[model samples]
Target: MSAEVSGVRIGVEERRARLRARQLAAVDDVAEVVEGLVALHATDPATVFLSVAARLCRPSGAIAAVEEALYGSGSGPGSGPALVRMMAMRRTMFVVSRESAPDVFAAAGRDIAARERTKLLEHLARGGGWDAAWLAEVEAEVEAALDRHGESGGARLSALVPRLREQVVVGRGKPYETTQNVASRVIRVMAAEYRIERRRPAGSWTSGQFRWARAEPLPERPVGPAREAVVRAWLRAYGPGTEADLKWWTGWTLTEVRKALKAVGAETVRLDDGAGHILPGHILPGDTEPAEPPPPGPVLLPGLDPTPMGWQDRDWFLPRSHRAELFDGTGNVGPTVWWGGEVIGGWAQRADGSVVWRQLTDRGAEAAGAVDRAAAELVGLLGGVRITPRFRTPLERELSA
Candidate 1:
């Protein structure tokens, strides 16, 4: 066993400041923020666009820019997307830079794909007349259908693949059991494998409805090296994270987390909360102050923004007392108000497309004023498109209602 390194410290305030410089600081490129923040949480659909807007110096064109990166036809025709939406760590959806998608998939997405396929197979087994062979046949047919007819909505694809329209009963013995068509699940599996991707919105960018198309194959990578690469990327943005933080964020086993940390040369450090670890040189032995410390931000981050979801242990940026109001029961975050890099409150979009906010804890008049400006800026950024977080928290729901 290797020896450990300790006696080093990164306090809450420093961590907050680091966060501002690393992620909260404004940038011009959409892809830059995506990679810099590791990846943007995309389950909510709107989260990716909002997260990008939050980081841009001028955000008026954020939605168009993001859409182009994801579905752009390139400089000419038939060129691929610059970013990829994948099932990532913790079985969640995220948008990652195209170059990083392979490692992201190898380290996190592949296992999730395997689990989803297995679960679907098990459900089919319970229903009978459906097995792995049947599932594979349907998958191939769906792929061919998408190719033959170009991209298609789920219902349209289902109509094209007659076999896919059949329903399966899930949770047969449970009170909340329901039937679901196989089209979506099969498409989900293919998406997880990078065999296909969502091509375009059936409605607005905020709409979950999407057309499906065959996706470019992800670059192949070794799992071990990829895990190390992913951990390194995480640490570059969210180092000093505890083992639990890495493990929980990745949905990897504790053993995998430990092995990857060792491979990445992570060193133990003391956080304000407890013992944590950071990549070597993450905090220099005697690192000097940045030429300029980040301002007390009052940045408004959307719910499920990558920074808030980057780690399982959030004490450095999120206070324990605000946990209940800020997150849904299952741990999805709500739109947050931040100042000095710490999450200070929540915000919501009202029925009239207005953005309203309230502080969970006071950071004073100056911070509040700054947050007010940020809110007004968000209102202009939104431009009357009402966005409801897919997962609503108590605070957001109350504010919106």
Candidate 2:
């Protein structure tokens, strides 16, 4: 059917091209790359660096550049760090541009903080018989400890506030039931509330353990306007997406999703799944006027990379047949191998510090060679530093073994 009748059909090729172009595949500037993606998934600390490396035109010095952009160099914006890592959207951590942090905080972080606080309180009451007043006192104590120490680790703060050392039973009667301290949960809530911020790690970029500091005041904007701004930015980066996609990505209600879209005046377009919304004035190119596709150089994206997790409907870029192999039971994606914007397979590092991949589809000898070259480059990048994913998929498990 014609695009006019079908509503601007965005075919696979166009989608692939857009992925390469918009994702900054050939760009080397770390700050700009992170800004373009809006947020780089920071759940796995290494994912931020690995994701930047994958998109750079040249991977050399990529890690240093990412660190500089993340921690800053006592300058501002271009010369210094313009991004800040914060927990937002589905309670996942992301490295968002400093300029965008306020909006993201208002749009999703505040609500998540509220839910998390309520949940933590319930857990405390049920698991430890702690009441709201006790929780409040503990939070105040923890905040005070952070203030006194000025950028301390969770363990340190827990040490300062003895109540933080108290344990609570989680998943009682379940096989995975375990006792956990209340320290991390309280700190996480404070971070989401913008009462504190997570600074650099105690060790390398791959370290998950972070030091916490009192957060600087962000420019205050109303939640409504902030939500609208966040939605607009999301559409610019991952548009032509369904309302469901926005809701899932932002952790907002259906009503909120509709409201944000309306506020942004998002335009609708046809997708293989259903009607999708794009930013106003965005027109998908037709087959007759197709854009040139990016060179089919293979790329190894770290697990939970934003490109793989950007949308709710991923069939346009990731094939259905490969889903089970590439993603874990929790729907978390592992390290993915991409060629021409489609997920062809997954990659993992071996015991010998070499990267190995299993191609689920045969994309000809040329593509295979390119993938091999990419794997070699990744191995060199690692320099014998064995990296393990926090969430391991079956394929990754098999390959690493």
Candidate 3:
């Protein structure tokens, strides 16, 4: 065991203050919020909007700004599609800042894309006597169709290229066996390869049906440098985390994680859980200002908010007792309630379009009142437009019922 460093402790309160200061909480700008956290979980379409809404001090302006950042064009210099939705880290979809997209693609997405492509090819081969030439021809046809028609939905593209309509068996003979449409797989491959992008939804913001557009070529970056850059950014925002946390978050091999940390010159520190790493100069002094911690108040974070999903080791902010209730079977989190930077419970909107919550811990009456007020504010923000989590947890399901 490494010797513990006295007076270098980062308690829960200190972490909470960092959350507010770093724009994880009480933030106002959508781009800045996304940039600060590096990315927002976007597996659920609603998660992107709700995540941004929860952080904005003024929730009224959040929707328009977030929409612009996500879908708007360059009206002026340095302002074109401020953020992009991409498949990265852990093979999950994330809304990443445009400035960070290239690095993310190079660092994490490229490998996953390769694996997906290989897997798809194998499945295709199993279905018939498909070869690499067939895949190339299909890809060319799909690209040509998109080029001629501009942005299109998967169904439209499938109509244009009849081959895309073919089905492939996945997990055959297994309990969870299912068939997958070749159109969806091709589209996924195109997106992962950075050859295409998902534009605005075909329906409302809550809809998952996205139109596809040709992607602008990403600026070239070497994999090593890109991995180091992303790792450094993550450490700065959610650091003092264990190697396991870094590996889990990035989906990188242990060797890759170690190399990236060494490349970034991360310093080792003793976390309550175990040894963790942080960027140099990130340590706070023993007698820093703001003697008392700031009141984090109550925040209703969306499902898969980066703050909660940021680390594999979540004991610092998430209580162990509430894990099963807050997270789904696949380990995806639901909409959560935060008080002073710690997740105290979970919340949900009833069918009547009212937001309700269940506090798992004995938070004081003052905290409870604040949480209630926050929930009411969130309900007002929605204006009776009830939102649902893509992956619902037990507590959220119970409360919503």
Candidate 4:
């Protein structure tokens, strides 16, 4: 005979309302989002970088908006060439949500194209070397051909030549390798008819990937707003986080982050995390998790998702000491496989969409089966409608208790 009364039971609706309120508070307009990141930078530099990246590169966001803000006028490098050079050194990789890859590529391509033209013309004027004269001659020819095409679809190819050349140089490691190299280098020059860089002829596509001909020099100016937007976005995705947390994610200085945050006023909130420390608002729920959070789904998060890499005090979801285990040297979070709110494993998909998983520990076949389901879910996100499990690796056999 069991008739038991609970010590403390809160109605589910009440908990949901509280949680919803906290989540809703985190919802911010694009502008507000921008402001918050500026503030975030003030408190934590690295975090601002990561947060901004998260914003510009969500599963469904655009890079152009942020790009313009950074390079358009304010604090960022105003010159396109300088911006490209600067961005090149920014080696930090941001994951382009699988769905937004097209748009991201387009925007990045535009930036690449504009910067290449300027670089070509400027480099030619400066008299770099052999590649310069050849590039200059090619620009003239390409422009003449474009004149015939009357700036239509064909001109796009003309415009794109310089871009392709730039990619080749960057990817291939040498500018004058063979006929293909000479052709690409000359094509870019002919298309632009503007002076070209002899030492740094732009590159082109090879085997699919675009290569950077010459090392992109660092950006000449600060990409303020654009950078700020990226920071804000990260916080939105993984907030209620500390400025230090933000710093760990971004690579900016605390001073820069502070300036950005100051720009964003009440739109951003600072909440205490039980301790005296204040952090971004979203991560801190006014209430605790209901006996359960959502039933863990098999979600295949992009390599750059904020969910896994955004927080600094990750003990809530992961063992704090091992946080570095999931991250690479550049602070890029690897692809993570999740069963619930926490990460249980990691997976990778080859270009062909073959799925492979590596579990953190041996959980046996039952766990292996769950990973299979999760991998399928991930493949769907990557545009592959269906995925077949090819293989799995367990870190070690079941440990003796």
Best by TM-score: 1
- Measured against the true structure, the TM-scores of the candidates, in listed sequence, are 0.93, 0.88, 0.90, 0.42
Per-residue lDDT for 1-401 in model 3, tens only?
A: 12234445555556656655564556668976887788899999888888898878788778778888898864677656778888999999999988899999999999999998998788788764577788888888888888999878888889999998877777778898787777887788889998889888798888899988788788988999999989888876776567788889999998998888777766655455422433212222222333243565888898888888987877767778889999999999998998876788899999999999988876799999999998988888888777889999999899999
What is the lDDT for 57 in model 1?
A: 84
- In model 3, which runs have C-alpha deviations exceeding 4 angstroms? 1-7, 73-79, 169-180, 274-294
- Quantify all predictions' global Cα lDDT against the true fold: 0.83, 0.80, 0.80, 0.39
The true-versus-predicted C-alpha distance at residue 243 of model 2, in Å, is 1.9
lDDT of 4 by residue, 126-207 (tens): 4333355555565555545444543323224445455333322222345653322334434443222212211111221001
Could you tell me which 10 consecutive residues in candidate 4 have the lowest summed lDDT?
A: 392-401
In lDDT terms, which candidate is top?
1
> Residue by residue across 156-230, what tens digits does model 2's lDDT show?
888889999999999888899899998888888878888888777899889989888777778887999999988
Clashing pairs in 1: none
What's model 3's lDDT at 307? 86
At residue 133, candidate 2 shows an lDDT of 95
Looking at model 3, which ten-residue stretch has the lowest summed lDDT?
279-288
Task: Summarize candidate 1's per-residue lDDT along 1-401 as a digit string, tens digits.
Answer: 14354667677667777788888888988978887888889898999999999998888899999899888865676466888899989889989888899999999999889998898888788854599889889889988998899989989998999988898887787998888877777888888888889877899989889888988887889999999989888887776577777888899998998888778777666566523434322322233353244677778889999888877878767778889999999999999988887888999999998899989889899999998898998999898899999999999999999
